[model samples]
Target: MPAYVGAVQVINVSSSGVFHIGDVIQIRPISNTKTFSGAGSFNTGDGLAIYNQYSATNTLDNDGIDQGINFNL
Candidate 1:
């Protein structure tokens, strides 16, 4: 079966330090019921930015699904 692209939510952010450019990171879902379909990336040009480069083909069947990405910095 094809995987689904579930919903994404930002749970927290780093309070200290500044993120820089050319940074890559992988983020997993916060909820145990949900899973990340693929890897993700991050880029910080002048500010912190997160990108979900991986394409999700599947989705959660029920409610309370949480997904997120990380910063390489």
Candidate 2:
């Protein structure tokens, strides 16, 4: 069987510039584990958010966090 992959939410935090193909971006799941959604802004250490720092070129396939979500940018 194949591994189950959940839907991910992409967010933009870069300066005023168009996103490129290989541009790295932050992403997280839209679940109850975090007090966030695909809409609106958020702050660090909001809720039970699972923090992850991934590149758009690598996505969740690279190094990331699973304990809590917090962005310092």
Best-matching candidate per lDDT: 1
Determine which window of 10 residues in candidate 2 has minimal summed lDDT. Answer: 31-40
RMSD of each: 20.9, 20.1
lDDT of 2 at 25: 57
What ranges in model 1 sit over 4 Å off? 1-35, 39-56, 65-73
Residue 70's lDDT within candidate 1 is 45
lDDT of 1 by residue, 1-73 (tens): 3445566566665654333334346433332233445444233376655666656655556666445434322
Could you tell me every candidate's TM-score relative to the true structure?
0.15, 0.13
What's the CA error at residue 42 for candidate 2, in Å? 30
Q: Residue 37, candidate 1: how far off, in angstroms?
A: 1.8
Judge candidate 1 against the unseen true structure and give its global Cα lDDT, from 0 to 1: 0.47
- Number of colliding residue pairs in each model: 6, 3
lDDT of 2 at 15: 46
Candidate 1 matches the true fold with a TM-score of 0.15
